[model samples]
Target: MNYAHLKEELIEYSKTIGIDKLGITTADPFLSLKDRLIAQQENNFASGFEHSNIDERVDPRLSVQQARTIISIAVAYPSKLKNPPKSLPGKRRGFFSRSSWGVDYHDVLNERLKKLEAFLEARCGPEAMMRMVDTGALSDRAVAERAGVGWSAKNTFIITEEFGSYVFLGNLITTIPFPVDKPLEDLCGSCTKCIDACPTGAIVEPGVLNAQVCLSYQTQTKGFMADEFRSKIGNHLYGWDTCQLVCPYNKKIPQPAHKEMEPDPEKVKPLLLPLLSLSNKEFKREFGHMAGSWRGKKPIQRNAIIALAHYKDQTALPKLVELMHDDPRPVIRGTAAWAIGKIGDSKKEENELLIAKKREEDQEVLEEIDKGLTLLGFAVEK
Candidate 1:
């Protein structure tokens, strides 16, 4: 079997199917990645969302028996919103990071991977290939870096020259011995833009991220947001982009041509108030298709409350009061209480918080109510 000729055919086929970039690499164990991941775990930098087994994450053979090569593909997503709606005083909106702007990349990229898998299976028999998008045990970035899809940048994103860091990466592990492509050179020399721009200083050092403090990771968390990050999150409801927005490599990149990745401004930057009252079914119907909806309504609603406080939108007070008094979830109720204080109309907000405090059963919610009263210049008993 002519592996070189097959690789050429795959590249051409990829172009026809909307894969923006493709590269191949031998499936040797990722020795360097294994060490870095161990360090990340030791330093408590891991987001805990990653696959826990280090061996499976770095070694392709463990994921796919007899894996000989990895084929990495990138799909570019748009950075700029087309005709974005204005976020005016009463009609404030919360931003979803660019990556969550359109249809979830997981679905879009997986469909492309399925097509590639079918093509490979037809040529090399049923047992030839296995494919993965971001969710799989194998590190998508590591595979992409080794396969020459892009260089892993200081912000920890795979930076493709054509798409900057705004590309979705995925891979196919195959038994076919395809010729390997060389990795890209490190291009982020002496650039501290991403590190400097990180709101929480989550980028602890060049090429290293303390995910626990990352606004993007924090936005996805289901629990009460730490107070330090509350103000820094601003109007971002799902994920944050300060690091990516400041990266020099991402500047002046052409808008992606892929229609699936184009941002629907209203969906990605929806009004914060409406989100607080969304029923579970309503949340699913409106946002389930977007990548940001993975953590469900609680975190988004909590962030939305924080965003309203960020705007200090007096219009949101009535709704915020209702959430503080009646919301079932303690995180939502507690966050709303904090927001009410932050967006203070001291007399009315303090009175409402005091009333809620008397009836609130959750200790965390009670603490937030007291904090709210205190923020409004009313003293609370210690």
Candidate 2:
């Protein structure tokens, strides 16, 4: 088989199908990434969302028996919103990271991969290929780095010279032996923009992220946000991109070729107050297509409450007070209490908080109530 000709044909076909970048590498074990993953685990820096087994993540052969060549593809996403809605007072807005904008890339990339898989199956056999996106057992970044799709930047993103860092990566492991592409040279010689710009200093070192401290990771968490991050999350309802926004590569990238990724200003920067009351169906209808809704409504609502608090929007006091008094979820109720206190129309909301405090049974909720009261300069009777 003339695999070199096949590789060229595949690259040409990829451009026709909207794949912004494509590269190939031998499907050998990712020796260096294995070490890094182990170190991330040992240092408690992993996001806990990754596939826990190190071997499964580093070896393509484990995922696809007799794997020979790995095909890596990138689809560029838009970095700028076309016409963003204003975040005026009494109508505060929350930001979803650029990654979550437009249709979820998972579906878009999977469709492209499926087409590529079909092309390969026609040439080889149907049994010759396996593919994966972000949720796959193999590391997408490792595959992209090895395949020369991009250099692994200090911000931990694949920085393609063409697409910069705003690219969605996926890979296909096939038994066909194609010549491998060499990895790109790292262009980030002395720049520390992403590290210096991280709001929580999650990038403990270049290319090393402590996900626990990452504002992006914190936004997706379901529990009550730690006190320290509550004020820092600002109006970000889902995911944070301070690190990526600061990268020089991301800043200079051309407009995205994929219209599917263009941000609907209303959805990515939705009004924060309306999110607090979204029914399951409403939340699904509004944000289900976006990547950030994967954790469901509670985390989004929890982060919405935090965004409200971050703004200290006094006009939201009534709704926040209602949540503190009537919401069934302890996290929402407690966070509302905290926000109400933080906003501090002391005479108006302090009585309501005291009353809620007396009846609240959850120990965590009680602690939040006490914190709220303390923030409001009220002496605790108990």
Candidate 3:
């Protein structure tokens, strides 16, 4: 098999199929990444979302037997939402981060990887490749950085000269022994902007992020948001862009050319009040296709309540009162109770919290109601 000609053919074919960038590298173990990941896990800096097996994550050969080459691909996604609505006092809105704006990128990147797999299989026969997207055991950013697709920025995202860090990455381990490409030189020279701008100091150092306090990971949690993070979340309902927004490489980034990656403005940044009232079926119908909807509507709803509180949306008081008293989910109920405290000033809001405080059985929700009463200047029962 002529691997050089095949590599050229693969790169050419990638452009026709909406792949923004492609690179080839050897399937050798990622020794440096393995050490970093081990330290990251040990120090509790790792986000629990990643595949747990460190061995499978660093070595492509473990995933695809006889893997001699790795094919890394990136699809750029839009960073800006067209015609975004203003999140004002009366009519507040919450925004899904740029990453969750379009169709779930996992689906988008996987679709592209499957096509690449078929193309390689047509040449190398069956079992020549194993494809993976974000959920794959191998780190997409690590693979992309090593494959010359981009430089691994201090924000820990793969930043290509063409697309910045706003790219979805995926890769395939192949048996073809394709000629390798060298990794790019680090371009983040003395840039502490991302680390400095982190609200929770999630970027404890340059490239290492403590995901536990990261606003992006904080928004995706199922339980009540931590006190420090809730106030810092602002109007963000899913993920965050503070790191990328401050990165020098992202300032002049182009809008995505792929239609599937373009965000529907209204859908990505919906009204905050309505989000709390969305029934399960309604939430699914409206946001099911969005990547932000992966944790179901619970996190979004909770974040929406916090957004309303952030804006001090008095108009949301009635709905928040209802959720505080009637919502079955304790996270939703507790968050709403707290939001009412945060936004409310009048006797009507005070009465609502006092009534909830009397009957609320859940200790968490009761504590939130007490907080509401305290915010309203009413002393709580001992």
Candidate 4:
């Protein structure tokens, strides 16, 4: 196929395959943000991958072996129903960040990209080689910006002119030379909503996100949920979206392009009693496919206990007590202790206080223990 003709066909094919926006970049332009990349690594915020190795990820000249043009695609996830479920009453339902509500995008994007690759191979045959890159050294947002589809916002997200920042990005690195578009200029002038709205201060500064402090990172992280940060978690059981919710760009984006992203009514505002006693196997069977399940059941279980505790719903006391002593994971047990104190009666509270004292470690749990004691009409000066 001729160069211009091939490019046009490919773009049309991408749209047909369900991509909302498609554009081409001559090379990754986000390469210039080296200092920001290094800062992320130094600060332990690089998503466990180096951003400095853009050349390694999709080096059109090397990795793709004669890569001439990079194609970038954006998947919009705008939610028409705005606002997370109010941790309060009479408010709109808030669910997981729209990006994470359904089947993992990693799976979705890769599947589509693979289909596109097969189509291209059939057309170009021995004349072309194509590679699909996601979540690697390649700067997806940078490539998207270079393609004139969007600009990098202060939140380090590519904000599309039409869709705002509620877009998931994927890119194709190929040897096919195609016309390239100019990069979009930064559009996040004087907007500090994402930075100011972060609960755990993860934003740190404009255009910088210290992932260690990011709530989304914490919720899905394995092992312990850091105690100092627990209170900021609020009622978020799986993921946090405080910053994204506050972003002006996310305003009025259509809700869940795919109906699958909508929360299962059974799962939404789940009753605390059941989650408090969920077995690991059962937990896995239920949430395994959802984005919230990425960190496994421990985090979700822990969050559930905390929310119950914070809710101070006394009806959950027996379940919380059972979880405090019976749950195998210490994080769950510890949060249970705190929760027991919050919702348990004098007798149940006293029992949990004793258990908390014997814990002998995990200061956060211990604090919960002490609070339980104090609430139960007992005094222990430590």
Candidate 5:
């Protein structure tokens, strides 16, 4: 394989496939990623499926025979329509973080990588094999930084001067020996916009995040969650985007050019009442093709209930009452109770007090019921 021309062809092919940026790097830079794997698991900040063995993920021995090079690529999915609707009365809005508001990127990236790998084999002979995308546990952001695609920001996101941190990353690991590139230095000097803007304080310190406290993670989990986190989750249904919205780099970049990536008008501003009544089947049909559908209907519905509670929208009272009594998940039931308290009047409050009296075992739900009763001029039956 002629290394020089192979490198040039790879860059040209990536651009042809519509990738925003591409880079070549040696696999050796990932040696340090194994060291932090344990601490990440212990802190519970790592994704549930994140490989615990750092060596297994980054080691070429596990991924490919005689692996020598990695081809890193980035795809930008910037939002063309900005200004998410405000939290005002009678305004229906559902904010899916830019990442989740389109067809899943993983599938798109994998197809592109496979095509590139096939081209390599056709040119470089049959000795090369490819492991594409985020597989093999390689540190993609680290690789992209080293390859000169972008710099790693203090927000723990890769910030490209041209595309910002909105680019989706994927990689091709192969046995071909390509020339490696140098990494850029971190350029997020003293910028704390992301850290300070986090509503749940999930970004505890510079470049560190606790996924448990993140609204993104909370919307993907089931069961009763912390009350404190609930109040701050705001109107986000799938993920949080406050940090990216405040970033200067993102502001300077042009909006997405792809029309298919635009938020669906029907989905862009989902009504809370309709979302609350979604059966599992309906939810799967509606959002099954999207990324946020992985956790099913429960979390999305729960998030909508939280937004209603935060807004104190009385129009949602009937829906909240129905959910309070009928929701199979206790966490959803508890959240419904909280929303009802914020919206219901004295008569409806007394109805909820009776319901609470029948099943007061769940301390969380009972607490919400008590607050509702108090707000509606009811006395505690002490």
Candidate 6:
């Protein structure tokens, strides 16, 4: 029953609701995507955060019974911060990626998706459609590509002509049969900027990502990050944007239209030192609304310690030493141990690490203490 007319009406409605782009496609299983997921798993490239059920991830029907069509929507977020806070010298700040700049896109996209779902439910009746954002079993990127929203680019982001890669994606699967749109042509020919610029070489090839090494993934992990990645992370406390920053398509991005997606400069880029002593409650009050806080304060705090070390901020050594000696969480203590050693080279700082090393009981913390001692040209007992 005239699903094409409904699609058109939904498209116009989406424009009014801050949806930057919308496209439609069939709900058939993503066969190639399943193969790619298997290969990614086999290669040990997946980050282990995705839904484990690969079948549900590739087949829309498994998620929405009688699924006949998929409508993908994109919401553009701010590319540039207005009057951003400085990450300078003693007042060094940690960065939250642009995607986390505003309110959590998951919430923003969910709001849009719910609205779209309501629009469809009215026309198609109740229980005929289902909505999902990033957490859903299906790959939003795959749906976007098949729906002509954008080209899946080398950095593994859907790069739309209108929003570049600075957009959020959400989709609806439905029983209604809508006219499908053709996929966009590949515009990223021989452009290896994202791959060449990846700090950990996480982009093994065009359109492929080794999530294990992606700084974005590394920052989200609630453990002592690998020593190799610690230095490469720079000031990133949440996610990394190096790949997108280097992509040519990302230049001159459209201004973010949704006010909810606009960032507060102070919040997104915050002073690093205070983050060290933040209680869970304080952290929640400050960052709970943002996307990056899902893993809670530990990962962010761990990354902040790494960022302080990345800057060699002597000012943070006190807090780092405090954590190394007193913080109950082993990951925090261990990461702080490493950062203290990595940042402080003086006799006083070396003595503090020596004291922490002697008293530290955790094997992981002891190892990090040893590394810190090694960094300061001190010998440790075997």
Per-prediction backbone clash count = 0, 0, 0, 7, 0, 0
How would you encode candidate 4's per-residue C-alpha lDDT over 238-277 as one tens digit per residue? 6666776788987776554554455554454455456656
Give lDDT tens digits, candidate 5, residues 1-382.
Answer: 5797888888888788767788878866466656666666778777564555677666754777677887888888865556555545765556667777667777777777887888888888775666565544776777788788899776778888788998888888778888877777677888899998888888878867787787777777776657787777777788777788788888868765654456664564567778888888898877776677777788888888888877778778877777778766777777787777666776856787677658767777777777667666778665
Give a tens-digit lDDT track for model 2, residues 210-235: 99999889999988899999879888
Q: Which stretches of candidate 4 lie over 4 Å from their true place?
A: 28-30, 47-63, 81-95, 126-134, 259-262, 345-347, 359-378
User: Which runs in model 5 stand beyond 4 Å of their true positions?
Assistant: 47-49, 82-88, 127-136, 359-382
Off by over 4 Å in 3: none
Instruction: Tell me which residue pairs clash in candidate 5.
Output: none
**Model 6 TM-score, 2 decimals:** 0.98
Question: What alpha-carbon RMSD in Å does predicted model 2 have with respect to the real structure?
Answer: 1.1
* Cα lDDT listed for each candidate: 0.91, 0.90, 0.89, 0.68, 0.74, 0.90
Q: Assess candidate 4 and give its TM-score to the true structure.
A: 0.85
- Score residue 95 of candidate 1 by CA lDDT: 93
Output the worst ten-in-a-row residue range by lDDT, candidate 5: 79-88
Badly placed stretches (over 4 Å) of model 1 are none
The local lDDT score (0 to 100) that residue 240 gets in candidate 6 is 91
Question: Model 2, poorest ten-residue lDDT window?
Answer: 122-131
* lDDT at position 60, candidate 5: 51
Lowest summed lDDT over 10 consecutive residues: which window, candidate 6? 119-128
lDDT of 1 by residue, 1-382 (tens): 9989999999999998889999999889999999999999999999999998999998899988898999999999998887889899999999999989789999999999999999888898876677788889899999999888999888999999988998999998988889989999989989989998887889898889999999999999999999999979899999988888888888999887887888888999999889988999999999999999999999999999999999999999999998888888999999999988988866988999989988989999998898888889898999
Instruction: Predict model 6's lDDT versus the native.
Output: 0.90
| Model 3, span 334-371: residue lDDT tens | 98988998999899999988888888899988888887
